[model samples]
Target: MGLVNKTRITDNLAVIIGNQHIDVIATEDFPFDVQIRFIKTDDAQLDDGSGKKVFTPEYQMAFAAAYKGKSAFFSNTEDIKSFTKQLKEIKELFEFATLNKQTWFDTASFDGVLSQKVGSL
Candidate 1:
């Protein structure tokens, strides 16, 4: 339903999830597509027509808050616990490249690894 694992660009202008780059267009006046992706199997920033998905401004704003350390990034204590669980389950994922948003695994493999331990997340 949502971007399960999203990376917040430092500028907060965008958030990338699994090869897709989602820009923040909080208002209708802003002229731009909200979602951009390479392909279902590649994160090279190429154009893909079928990779489209629905976008919601509210959800994007919530994800942008994650870039602000002072923001209530975690809704409650349980949110922290869920994050902690993810850390323990996959420590290697914390190390990510800053050049551009990327996923270490393909959809199926990534989902398989995380879903196996997503009891609380």
Candidate 2:
């Protein structure tokens, strides 16, 4: 048992850009593809004691972990689990992206990100 046995990714995570909040949803499995868009901004904020709604750190991580048009591929359980660990961390951090009103992605890019799938699991 490794990251594989310890992680499950059946949900989406949140990300923050400026004051805007976005969701990180998996559109594909192989060579992972992640896009950005508004999902829960209305309901995705903490009171912060001053009635100021704010995003969480998990959102930051997810945003940092993904960008628009990003692709992900896992060839082995270890790789999948390794990526899963990041997602799990974000989940723990919404509780824990596109580019438009309907579909948008972050222009920002990362060398290693777990967004969508490339080929097979």
For each candidate, the alpha-carbon lDDT, in order, equals 0.31, 0.36
lDDT of 1 by residue, 84-111 (tens): 6533322222222212222423431232
Model 1 CA RMSD to the hidden true structure, in angstroms: 16.0
Which residue window of length 10 is worst by lDDT in model 1?
56-65
Model 2 bad stretches (over 4 Å) = 1-69, 96-121
What local lDDT score does residue 69 receive in model 2, on the 0 to 100 scale? 35
Put down candidate 2 lDDT per residue, 34-105, tens digits, no spaces: 433332222344677987656532212222334233566779999889677656644343332222222122
Best by TM-score: 2
